[model samples]
Target: MKTLGIIGGLGPESTLDYYQRIIALYRERTGDRHYPEFVIVSVDLRKGLDFMDANDLGGMANYLLESIDKLARAGADFGIISANTPHIVFDEVAPRLPIPLISIVEATRAAAKAQNLKRLALFGTRYTMQASFYPKVFARDGIELLVPDLQDMDYIHDKYMNELVPGKFLADTRAGLLAIVDRMKATSDIDGVILAGTELPLILRDPIHDGIPFLDTTKIHVEAAIAHMLS
Candidate 1:
């Protein structure tokens, strides 16, 4: 099996989740105690987040490029940055790396298409929702993307990150997210919703959509990584 490399620690918790998912997936597929070989280069998330908080694209890109190079040097066969927001530097990072970076954007697009989703709502960090990285990629694949209202985006950037991602996983957080989903359901005919943030699934469970489907980007990413390794 090919070794996987992860560019991680956009936030430590989410990165750990990705690592566990990779292990669980390998165990399930191969039914062996042995796990997939992988390496992780965890970057200083405070620096990245600070750049993002200030909307400094140059700083963010530079930070990501450096991290990707470190992963390449560490002997990653293929690389993946474990966070969605940092993918804003996908163009810059992709060209610099010697190994393929399995993109969460591409993985999510494939997941949406596989489910035949025409329109989808996205919930993630402010940068992810407001910027073109995710929406542009999905649009290229002929999928329409929707974002939450400004107030909700504020909730995500301020409260979700500061409180939920770091806080102990709680029922209230799940309720709050479901409430947002309910509001989206009322306003749009979206075919589904994408949990665009890696930490989102920690708050959301079962994701009752009444009828619409929900796409978990983290799960999609894990599946993509496993396929890349085993195939």
Candidate 2:
């Protein structure tokens, strides 16, 4: 297996999740008790996130490209962005990289398809929910993605940036998030909730949510990366 590179530090907390989980998965599969060689570039995400807020996708992609280039130079055979919101510009950045790039959104889409899930409710940054990135992939696979309404979108985005990204997992925030999920379930025939943000699992760690599967994008992305490396 080639050395894995992770474009991380989009938020420090979730990057830790990606690193630890990848090591754990590798340990389980190889039984070597040693982690495979990997590189991580923890980029400053504020500027890229600001660009996304301004709808400057090219700027966001270019900003991330600089760090990704470092990973490639470090000899990673392939890499993955450890966050979802940044994947909005994955198309623009992946083409410019020396190494292949794995996409969190794409991996989750395949997972949704494999489970034959027809509908999913998304919780992530506003850019991820309002945009067509996940929706585009899901649509092609005949899956439907539901996002929180405008008010809930604001709430989710705010909590994500101010709370979850900072590693402050408040009980009230968890309840609020679950309330939205329950609300969505009551109003729709959604099959599951895609905790689309990588840091979301910190708050919503259970594999199931209100009896529906929690489609954990972080876990899905790491599992797929491990499979690719071991294959």
Candidate 3:
């Protein structure tokens, strides 16, 4: 098996999910009861959030690039950003990186296509919802991706940073998210919902619930990374 490198701590909770899920899935597949060889470089979440707040995705890309470089130095065979919002800069950074970096958007796009989902409602940080990364990738497969209204976007992003990132999962917050999904169903012909934020599954972990499929980007990306590593 190849060594997998993860650029994590885009927020702490989701990074932990990636680390644990990868190990569990790898073992479940091969049943070796041995942990995989992997390197996790947890970047400062503040730095990335700072750039995001300033709307300087270029600076965010530079921040992530620095981490990827270190992962390369540490002998990582391939790399992945552990969060979705930072992937707004993926196209700009992946080409410049020294190793292959798996993209959450691309992985989710493939999964949606396999499920034959034509229209999807996306919920994530403000950046991920507004970014062109997902639209471009999904467009290639003729999939329609819809985001929530501005007010709902604000609600989701706020709860994500303030509550989810800090490992705070309140019942009220989960209810708020489910309510948003219900509104989305009423307003759009969405066949499924895409949990574009890695932390989202921490709250809404079920794939099929609330009258629509929820595509967990973290699971999609992790499964793809496992295949790459095992192959």
Candidate 4:
């Protein structure tokens, strides 16, 4: 099996999820005791979060590029950054890395298209929702992306970074998230809600949408990586 490289630790909880998911999927497919070799380059989430909160694009880009280079030097075959927000710097990171960087944007877009979705709601970091990176890519694929309202976006950012990422999953946070989903369902008429954050699935497993689908980017990303390796 081919080795995979992950640029992770944008938040530790989701990073752990990605690591476990990759191992489990690989084992399930091959039914071999040996697992695929992988490397993880976990950067300082606090710094990345601070830069994103400040809209410091240059800082974010530089951090991501450096992280990718580190992963390349550490012998990663191909790389994927686990966080959705950091993908905003993908354009900068891709060319600088010695190894190929698998794009979450492409993976998510492919998943959305496979579902024949024309419009999708997104729940992710503020950088992902407010920035042009993810939404623009989806738009190019002719899919309309709907983000939460400003207040909701703020709530998500705070709850995720302060609580969920820290492994502090509370009942109130879950209730708040469900409420946000409810509001989006009522307002957007979207075919699906994309759980763009890696940590999101930790809070919402088997998410029910009263009929609408929920696109779990973390699962989609892992499936794509496995497919790439097995193919």
Candidate 5:
């Protein structure tokens, strides 16, 4: 198997999720007694957020690129970033990385296309939702992406930074997020919800909600990384 490199700790909570899930799923899939070999470089969460908050995408790309370089030097065969928002600069950074960097967006897009999903509601940080990257990528396959209204976007971003990133999964916040999805399904005819944020699946664990599937990006990304490793 190829050595998998992960640029993690975009937030500490989701980084742990990526590590645990990759090990568990890899074991189950291969029926192996031993775990897959991998490397992780956990960067500062605050620095990344600062880059986004300042609209300094170039800085963000360079920051992630530096982390990926560390993974390469440490002997990773390929790399993947653990968070969604950093993917705003994925195109900028992937080409420069020494190892192949698997994209969370492309992986999710393939999953949606396989399911024949026409439209998906995206939930993530403000940088992810407001950015055109996800919509543009999905649109290549004729899939449409919808984000919450400005007010809901604000709420999602606030809770994401303050609660989800910090590992505080509250019932009221979960309910509020579900309500947003329900509205999108009703009004926009969405077939799926993209838990675009890695930490999202931690709070919204169920695969399906109100007949619309919640595409756990962390799971999809881990599966993609494992596939690349085994291949």
Candidate 6:
């Protein structure tokens, strides 16, 4: 099997999830106890968020490029950015990479398409929600994606940085997020929810919430990566 490289530590927790899930899934598929050959280049989370704060996407892309180059040098056949927020600069960084870089958005888009979900409610960091990337990708398949209201976006973003990224998943926060989902389901008639942030599934563990499927982007990306590796 081909080796995988991950650009991680966009936040520590989700990156760890990607690593663990990939190993477990690869073993289950191959029916082997041996661990897969993979390398992780954990970037500084603060610096990455700093670039986003300053609106210096070029700088962020360069930072990611440097890490991916290190992955190529470390013998990664292909690579993936383990978090969703950094994918704002994915188009810029991917073309410059030495190895193929799988996209969390594209992977999720494919999964959403497979489920025949026409409308989805997206929840993530302020960066992911405000951006046009997810909408643009899903629009290609005629899927409609919606973000929460500004107030809810504020709540989600605040909790994401202050709580989730630090590995703090509070019960009240989870309830608040679910409340937003319930509201969206009622107002927008959304058929599915896209857990666009990698850390989202860490808190919202269920596959379905009130009959709406929660699209787990991390798991989708891992499955896509494993398929790519085995192919």
Candidate 3: tens digits of C-alpha lDDT, residues 39-121? 99999999888998899988998989999999999999998999998889898997899889998988999999999999899
Worst 10 residues of 2 by lDDT: 90-99
Worst window of 10 by summed lDDT in candidate 5: 90-99
Give the clashing residue pairs of candidate 1, or none: none
Candidate 5's TM-score reads 0.98
lDDT of 4 by residue, 11-104 (tens): 8999999999998999999888988888999899989988877888789888888877887788777878898888888887666677887888
The lDDT for every candidate, in the order shown, is 0.84, 0.89, 0.92, 0.85, 0.94, 0.93
lDDT of 3: 0.92
lDDT of 5 by residue, 29-68 (tens): 8996999899999999999989998999999999988898
Flag clash pairs in model 6: none
Worst 10 residues of 3 by lDDT: 204-213
Residue 55's lDDT within candidate 3 is 91
Error of 1 at 165 (Å): 2.4
Q: Which portions of model 2 show Cα errors greater than 4 Å? A: none
Candidate number that wins on TM-score, 2 or 4: 2
Displacement of the residue 197 alpha carbon in candidate 4, Å: 1.1
Colliding residue pairs in candidate 5 = none
lDDT of 2: 0.89
Candidate 6 residue-wise lDDT, 1-231, digit = tens: 799999999899999899899989999988977888899999999999899999999999999999999999999999999998889989887768899998999999999999999999999999999999899999999999999999999999999999999999999999999999999999999999999999999999999989999999999999999999999
Q: In model 1, which range of ten residues has the least summed lDDT?
A: 201-210
Count of backbone collisions in candidate 2:
0
